[model samples]
Target: MNKTFKIYAVIFIIIMVILALLEVSKKEVTDWRKNFDVNEKSPFGLFVFNKEIKDLFKNNFTKIDVTPYDYYSEKNKKPHNILVVESEVDQESWNKILDEVSKGSDAMIIATRIPKNISDSIGFYNSKISFEEQNVLKLTDKKYQNDFIELDKFPSGRGFSYIKPNVQVLGKTVEKNNEDQANFIKATFGKGNIYVHCEPLFLTNYYLLKSGNVKYAQSIFSYLGDKETIWFVESNTKESSSLLRFILANPALKYAWWVFLGGIVLFIFFNVKRKQRIVPIIEPLKNTSADFVKSIGNLYLQEGDFHDMMAKKAQYFLNKVRLDLLIDTQNLDEEFSKKLQLKTGKSAELVNEAISLIKKAQDPYAGVMKEDLGRMNKLLDGILK
Candidate 1:
């Protein structure tokens, strides 16, 4: 390769090596799955609640883990309070929860967004809250008054607004002008109350594990009262493929696999070449008529047959006259000479002289000298010109 091309290739290889090394040396951060699964180790999971608030729940109520479908399937006579965190319930699940709540059982739903039917039925609408920085949350409820709870910067969640008359505002954010926007609301239906908290992230491990933030979550649980059984609904429903699950579970393997795939793609891209078939060469045909005639004349000269050579020369001359001048050669008399002279535009004397030489060569025993052949050749050359 040329010097410039070699340098470019070296630079490319170096860049690829650097990128591969960076990828290999990279460290994965905490998994932090955004779902509110109680079983997961992610920051948004309820593992912290199970660890810190389990004893508190044991003292006041029974904590049960089950799906909405399973909870509604049980026909027990016991009074149970439902708790859903960061989960979207289908229409059937919503109907089941509504039925349970309408039958004098309390329920608390903490999610970024509640179902539209539930929101409309509960007399509140939730909307996304955007802020330049993190906002602090505080309990506005008279019974569980606390200091401001500092949340993370750029919290990813929504907030609620009370639309129904007599709806109780349980909590509000302490950030500047956002104080009037309610984040938690309690609405009474037939005989029980439905507590809806927009900021479900408050109950996550990331916030609860933070110093003193656990009190903010505990304050919300105070509204649950003395219900016998508390059901914790699982919200993460999307199942990942086995390969993706494995990669996501192992950080080192994920990065290594990506680097390996990238290298393989680059190798194939540079190494690939186009293949073509070879073409053949061909030559034009050659005319050997003149060469053949010269060889025959040479053979006749070697044999000393002047009559045959002169006769062939006369016949060839007459054939040329017949073809080129379009004249009769059967009879080489004076009349024929006159006609040839007219067609060739030559003097009658020269035409008659050529005819006389041809007649002489036609004789069987005639012998032609080299000087006579030269004279005849000169005459034919002049006529051709």
Candidate 2:
């Protein structure tokens, strides 16, 4: 049994060591999952175009950073071009964007999924298009027909379907199967136009670096036309603090945080001592004198030593009389009874009865019965009361 236990313990230790090494050596991959956050440094982020796009607008327009709530506010209502990129747009933000665009501010949205209100307002709906093999994209305009543009990595992106008659197709996906799907469209709102692009990954860093793909991205920008001022709406989000972000980014630190929380729980479970009251050391009340006399009388009765029990009772009664009444108990005559009656304020009959019982109890050869003992107890009780 001991050998088997040792082998199991060794195996556990080796497994733990391997897991710890893996945890330590594991590197966090650059998250290429498309978030479209312009501030993020990931490959799918828009950090590379931050300088170039801002410089592009520097000569003709001023760049401003705003949120959906801020841009819709009354105090900041300037007619400028709006750019938004998100994974999923909510109804409220979509409505606000439509309202802003209807007021003659051109808006361009690059997202995987657009909300129902925005899609309905633009007269188009988006659907997922999956390519079993690699595919390339082509602009529907004749001017960009020869441009080489390929979306080789992202096999699953979005495409526009059920486009209304009023909407114009801007670009389409070119697959070897000849299954060309519309992915970009331009629709007219109240006074301004809304350009909806289904594939936002085309603007990401990975595809932007592809050969001759920059021209494809640049062609999509031309739809904005001469509306110079640009308002980039940052997604409304609760960003994590620097320390928390670091802990989440590192696996070892995240594990250490969990271990620390577990230690706290264990400490509270083991160390939350319950406060208890101090127990008092109470000495049992010293056996009362009356109880002691009753116990001795019971012992004498058990042994059938009634004469001795009577003698002890008489002696104790006389002693109590002498101490409490300050009267002599040497004699048991009429004179003694009278003195006891006067001192204790007892009736003469009660005092005489007690004296007579004491005299009977003092006789050495007297035979005491249960009736005689009960009568003596009654007489003594009357006198004492």
Candidate 3:
């Protein structure tokens, strides 16, 4: 790998290590948002309350995932205390709850506000904004008149701004410096009672988390006697499941999938083989075999070895004659020259002279001269050309 690649890989590794350490060492912060989901464990959620609600009632306390309208639409002979916490009751649900209450089924709905239509019909109105962030409540009844519960961030939105004469005030906000404001009230229609509490945040985990504050909730829930209460909270009614949904439902699998995705991204980042520099153009070297042979010839000529050179040339020419002209060089005589003349299509004088030179060069004692070598070479070229 190149120097640049090595440096980048080191930086990438360092950054990854730092990120992993920070992720491991980071502290988990407390969530204070008012999400009233039954499964949420955050401070202002209903996880704790839902888990411990069964202790408040002695009879069968069933949890209905469906809305009150859907639950009450069917025939239920037994009396049940319907409990709905931290939710906006719709028109159909409100009407259905009223019908259920008229049929001797009690419903206690705790919410910051009720439907305006239902509020207008019953002459009960709750304010949408509360100037006070904290609240203290006092029960109006003579038996629990001195009972007071200190609360934080009370009237999540607002308290009861107006209450009808027929609806008896259950509890009111009391402050030494301010006048009392109606926070809780109950309206009796038929044989059952529909109690509306304006502060639903009081029943969340933040309040019940403290041992002392659990009583504040229990005191408020005391109105819901030991009867089978149907707790209706938001629920996912979806009947279909997707592959991705299944993976996300499991924490370990979800994190593993995310890690796999991250690995793909890192692999793509470091896969730099395709990002190389362009290659340089290079002309190929020319053929040098002919030049090498010319150099050897020049070396032999510089040595002035005419007799040896003549003998070497005679041997090579005779071999060529035997192979190409099909004339045997076993004897350099008149018959051989005559055959070569016919095969080579050369003059009789040229063929005869080359044969004579070959015969002279073959004799070692003949001492072939340079002139003889030149004339023989010319004669051989003329015969072969």
Per-residue C-alpha lDDT of model 1 across residues 1-385, encoded as one tens digit per residue: 5586567567767876787688668896877567677666688777777666656565555554556766677855455677777765677778778778888988888877777777999888756576736777778866667645776644653566446776888887656545556778888877778888887777777887778787777778878867664655553433455787788568677766766776677566665654656767778677799899899878877888766666778898889888988888898887788888777799977877777777878987666777776677677667767
Best by lDDT: 3
**Full-model lDDT for every candidate:** 0.72, 0.73, 0.77
Would you estimate the TM-scores of all the predictions?
Answer: 0.54, 0.55, 0.61
lDDT per residue as tens, model 2, 350-371 = 7777787788899997777878
Backbone clashes in each candidate structure, one number apiece? 0, 0, 0
Worst 10 residues of 2 by lDDT: 230-239
After superposition, candidate 1 runs with Cα above 4 Å error: 1-24, 30-33, 59-66, 177-179, 235-385
What is the C-alpha local distance difference test score of candidate 1? 0.72
Model 3 lDDT vs. the true structure?
A: 0.77
By lDDT, the candidates rank as 3, 2, 1
* Cα error of candidate 3 at position 329, Å: 99
